[model samples]
Target: MEMLIVVAIIAILIAIAIPTFASSLNKARIATDEANIRAGYADVMVNVLLDDNYDAENGNASTAGQTKYYLQKDGSVATTDTNAYKTQGKNDSATTEIAGQKVGAWAKDKKVTYQYDNTKNQAVISFE
Candidate 1:
């Protein structure tokens, strides 16, 4: 009877732990996605500065872990993807179309903001 009780307890613990572990893994994925997108934004800025073409769009170099990137063009960004030259929406909005994409704003409602700071000559990707 004691052995059966131990087995039951162990089974219960495993069942509980598995979902929690899965949840944490998902959260980690979201964080990774956010970082990837920010990196993409930085890449675009570097390319723009180096090439002297602010009108061109650049994407993320990451081939895995959610394909998210900023699509910049004409000194403004829209995540539409309709034009292929420029994507429509903001950070969170833009990410929805991309697989495994998670925007701070979309995921946590008040976590993400993407901005272009012309004064600093930088594309500022920040989270709330």
Candidate 2:
């Protein structure tokens, strides 16, 4: 009888813990995704600013946890490292939209390829 009670208690504890653990895992995943996107955007912008037809190159060097960013391809392939975070929706609406530019910040991909176009013509290049 005592063993049965203990088993039931253990089962109850596991049931209560599973949902909480799952929730935490989800939150952490979302946080990591957000961080990756922001980092990707920053890297892309830095590479763009370094774009000088004379002195600096238009492409960015590959980071430790990030891919190489390029303004426009010049018949050469872009470089990429093993992205620490592999998340879905990297090429979804977030990356494909002009308003969101979410793809600009996706770190899950191998290459941060960008088409330099200011559809808004606001003169300010930002992800937000």
lDDT (0 to 1) per candidate: 0.45, 0.42
Model 1, poorest ten-residue lDDT window? Answer: 60-69
lDDT of 2 at 8: 100
lDDT per residue as tens, model 1, 1-128: 99999999999999999999977776676555555555556554554454433432443222211222234333333333332222222333544422223333444322332444444444455443
lDDT value, residue 118 of candidate 1:
45
TM-score of each: 0.45, 0.49
| Index of the highest-lDDT prediction | 1
Provide the clash count, candidate 1.
7
The per-residue C-alpha lDDT of model 2 at residue 54 equals: 18
- Give a tens-digit lDDT track for model 2, residues 51-107: 443122323322311333332222222233333334423322344333253334443
List ranges where model 1 is wrong by over 4 Å. Answer: 51-105, 108-115, 124-128
